[model samples]
Target: MATGQDTLWEKFIQPLFGFLIDREALKELSDSIDWETESDRLKNPDLIYPEYYKSQNFHGIKGGYLNSSAAVTYDPITKHALPPNENWNREAVIKAVTGNPLKIIDLGCGTGSTTIMLKQAFPNAEVVGLDLSPQMLVMAEYKTQLERLNVQWLHGLAEATSFDDSEFDLVTASLLFHETPTAISQAVLKEGFRLLKPGGQVIILDGHQKTLRNTTWLTDIFEEPYIEEYAKGSVDAWLGKAGFTQVLTEDVWWTNQLSTGVKSISNL
Candidate 1:
């Protein structure tokens, strides 16, 4: 079933998001950034700043604007289609954490796609979407209004979420890990663990750098400046050290993977 989903994602969704949407947005966003100069600095021995670890506003504006445009252009059909199969994984995460309904938090939820999807899947559960970009939050809010989904949108950082501890039944992130620094990534994981209720689950859908195997050439070709390093990062180890149990990591696509961990019920 997962394999069939992956095939559909690659054959259909990937092209739609990557070529139809992401490529143009990424190109414009990259051009707006000083990638060449930053690339040079990254090659320097003393330059410790990671090349891709930037929190600039242009990324927010460009991404938010493009996503908003995409949202508006796609209208009802496109708006409904944004979640992709990752939403299916989110449903599985909800089932894994609690047999019935569960409150879910979507960290780094861009444009509120995952957040709305969660609401659709579990209408009874409270859903919160947190992001660092205010512009993105606006776009998310717009989408939520269009769908009439009752979701709370918050402008917050993943590394230092404002929510109280043990507040959520499940915490989820999709396509977010690879864009953050190692330190920030660890901090986000810790925050996720802190936010979950006892027996709550943390489900992350992101790239699986370790699973590239035979597609090294294509992987490298398609991967951006930070892809290689992000792929090599030890997210599973970070989650384990953060006091999560039942840590599970699995390959999903040419680059995508799903990693999850559970907060023990005793700790809740």
Candidate 2:
């Protein structure tokens, strides 16, 4: 599972993206970038966020969401990290959520990978993507604009957002929970519940916490600060406690799982 790209991700790219960043990022992939401007461009001044969102580097990436270098490398790194299966793994998430969705929101959507796929799958839907990382959102914005996909980008926290209550028809979070502490993960679930309308469903795709089927290699190569708590915990129970019902969880790939829960009418 170790791609031996550790140097490329951690050390070598560090000096490149951190200090010697090139002003123009689109022309060359290897150039270091000023992520602060990228972040400010996508950031919302009024949205409130918890401390945990700012403190940890969940993926061993420097500056976490604030690094422009990390943002550009994220998509390619993940694709190579999971290889051929990575493409379909995201597709499984979209497929798991059934019915036609009119309004959709993707949480922790990094570099617009899942966000783009979501728009492609449901072209007519008004899709919005939110991420803590403005650098990632900048990359997402660049991507969506290039593809001409009308996906909306936002800078906000998933656990707490400025959106109205029960505003979305379907809410989805991909590869988010494992990066966060268990407490924050639960808060995110509660937030998802609060955002969904009565009977609206929420979809979550993340690392397989329950099954130790084939994760040894993943741990060897990657650095995930909160993945252990996520794998051992019960997202199903969290959703239940958040007042969601009709919950279902399924394994999508060796490293991923997709879970869906309908917002309970009783909770309404």
Candidate 3:
């Protein structure tokens, strides 16, 4: 994601929200974490960041997700950011889930919000949360620790994960596609297809494209680089292009939408 420093979000809104958060406690938490050790534990040494990701500023943050501040402020800002409600927006993903999957992966799982929810939804499932930012993964691990949920967090890319083919029963991403270029988002869907077992499913929860195209100011509130491009495309089209069957996309909470598709039983 990229944004101008002079944008409305950067000029006023982000600062206002920053003032509202408990900075003292956030600093304390940041100081407490052994960033080096934690990052080393979660990061994949062989992983390489793409130019689009490594070079851009996300959410008006200078270092994007790689910054520790992005991790610290993510949950609080996200709670109020989602329309109607944050948990409600995320729960739409859970509601869209089709089966009791034994293995699950949440791509671009920043701070493990929806990832944790997935674990709670299916306590027995082996859940994993993967992101490009090790800083975000540290916060994700901390959040899961507070929840007492055993979720595996990994530092990796959504479009090119290290996981084997036909390994997962479910693959999901929440509010992730809008942050990346359309080509990367499409590639991620294709990667999801490769990761799923024959007859498994992929679900995506993201902004309602129709709503976004109509409501420009909604996106203007934040410095979203690819949101406009993302809004112009269709998740259904992407899923179908990735060779998923039974594709469906439905509006959720007016602002968000859930799109789902299943791999063919004979896709092995």
Candidate 4:
């Protein structure tokens, strides 16, 4: 599915890792998985991918999340990318939760890393991790299987999910906004607002806008097409526009930020 276009990951990091790690072992590991069959089981055949998602290469991968290669390689690159530590970065999302949420959903949940953490933190909650990429969902399912975690991995769009309105007690998105266009990001926030029940909270973990704005190199280091725009915008303002109350945005580590908002209890 690669378009033969070189990305920063492909041009630099991948080659560096290949030099240091066992490429044959990695390839053998990739080949060992039944990618097609596994992915097909999680795929929503009726879902149509948007032009915004399909047109661009992500993380130097030609087909972006749609490709099996992206799912295979995401965790390795992510471990190096997240500052402090990947687990610490993701744990911030779990720590942001307020009350005991019975129903939770993670939008754009890549490979179920953070999603798994959510389940671990709130074991009694019903956790659902949804992503547009079936390949990514396959990896997520595999991970949950390993942990014996009761989590649902769905192939669906973040901006528009199939679930009923006001269903979830909590909604979370980690490192998802920067990869999407600003408008789409806004729409996703609105969708999160719609999905949450009255008095429910929505948590977003992504790049620190101010840090990214001040440091051009951070955005430049990755092949993220929309990060520059994401850095320029305000998630606080977006949450306000989406009809959320008690909104707050706080810095996490040096490069990331966590934004949270609650739906009004009076909505009922």
Candidate 5:
């Protein structure tokens, strides 16, 4: 029953279109909407508590767009040729943590795509996905179940996580920083510092503020109002103040950026 269009969609069009739509639509929507007014509406209640999953809509268009867009770029074969930008940074995190990880936590693990990849990369590590959206977490759970993967899904927030101090071997985030407010962003960094064990790493994979200059027209067309703010934000400074050391920042293709730092073992 499958047709050429289906194959093409599966192979190329879907991923490309999803990617374009995600970047473009998110930027436009963020710019047009008053985030302060919509913050409550956007917050998924199921995320605030685990018992409310029935109210979530896992297949909504926006959720679909996010899941598909993220998954497409996560596929190593497709991602390398297309260069989802964070490929190297992702690899770096995996290599650094996988060596002796007993457990790993992925904050803002949307649809668990990145979490799934991390699980595949290090099957020995017990991987957990934490997201504030129950809809996204549901999709992630479904996908992981279908794939027969063993991953723990938790409803949580990055700004104020439920995990105890030094609970994880590594704390990683992908494409999450730019979406939050400045204060919340700082809280996320501090939370990462608090949750990670001594000598553990906090690897961030997101858009590079500096690289925004190179894609001015694209950014404008994409309708990203926060793009400028994110470009001007001081993520590195916040991380440094949070007490992380050996900070490394790099720009990747597809406009993604990497920031890696080590938590001081002595502080723990």
Candidate 6:
């Protein structure tokens, strides 16, 4: 189902990023990073992530998120790749969240966009960004430091986190579900259910599903292997099955869909 553009990004753009990556600089980043502060960074745990996530050269980035340079360049590349949107970071969905959430966890938070935005909206809320890649966490952490934000980054898998049950008031994931396989997506939904306090909400912001999307060019342009399956799948049903209530989905800025739901009060 890949198009000519997909072939181009895979053949040219990906290799170009590899040439641009600085291996020497990346190797040195680990020396000063304090992995244990606030965030749980289990650097080399006995856990396993999906093979696609671990192996793919996502978004034509070299070494994927494993490369610190990829982390350094991911935001700029994606921003340029996306069409103009007034809700740049999908702030509308974030604003629509009803809870006066005091703690938030953003799963698969690449570069901490959703995580930081959540913290910016709720300054007093304890916010955490969790991702499987250390390099991505480094970029997220560096951004947090620059902004002097009280956001913490965790290096861990989204499907299975070390966080305790009902540890958060809200769980958010942006552009994550589409990249993951359906099984992994199911696991992440279950994990979201586990991580939320009773009545806590889960918000998933991702590529516009075919249900609401007019074009498939973005998927072709980016070579998203899982987009076809994701667009066809029902995250809303998954949420309900995971013991969520009042599940809803709405079209958001550009080609993104926002699915939000609450855990039942009875679960409390």
Go through the candidates in order and give each one's C-alpha lDDT.
Answer: 0.63, 0.77, 0.91, 0.88, 0.64, 0.76
Model 6 TM-score relative to the real fold: 0.83
lDDT of 1 by residue, 7-69 (tens): 444555546555455456545643554433433332223323323334221211223222333
What is residue 38's positional error in candidate 2, in angstroms? 3.5
lDDT for residue 187 in candidate 4, whole number 0-100? 99
Over the stretch 1-268, how does candidate 5's per-residue lDDT look in tens digits?
A: 1232334345564575566555565455345534333334444455544222233222122332223333333332234332444356466556545347678899988767678878998788889998776445655776787899999887677777777888888888876776555666778889989988888888887776777656554334333334555666877887898899988777665567778888987665
In model 1, how large is the Cα lDDT of residue 188?
A: 91
lDDT of 6 by residue, 1-268 (tens): 3743447677665566556666455557544565444234435466565687877766655456776556666775665554465247568557768868999999999888778888889998999998887767777888788888998777778988989999999999988988888889988999999999988999988877764245655566577677787877888888888788989988775576789989888755
What is the C-alpha lDDT profile of model 3 across 146-260, one tens digit per residue? Answer: 9899999988999998899999999999999999999999999999999999989899999999999999887777777789999999999999999999999998988899999
TM-score of each: 0.67, 0.85, 0.95, 0.94, 0.68, 0.83
The residue pairs in collision within model 3 are: none
For candidate 4, the 10 contiguous residues with the lowest summed lDDT are 1-10
Model 2 Cα lDDT, one tens digit per residue, 1-268 = 2233563336444444444444355337535345666678788887666666666664566556667767876775576555357888888878877788888999888888998988999999999999987878988988888898999999888888788999988999998998888988888889988888888989998877755334654544456656666777888988888888888888776567788899878767
Flag clash pairs in model 4: none
RMSD in Å for all candidates: 10.1, 4.8, 1.6, 2.5, 10.6, 4.6
Candidate 3 deviant stretches above 4 angstroms: 266-268
Candidate 5: misplaced stretches above 4 Å? 1-89, 96-98, 221-225
Ten residues in sequence with the least summed lDDT for candidate 6: 35-44
Candidate with maximal TM-score = 3
TM-score of 5: 0.68
Candidate 6 Cα RMSD after full superposition onto the native fold (Å): 4.6
Worst lDDT run of 10 residues, candidate 5, spans 52-61
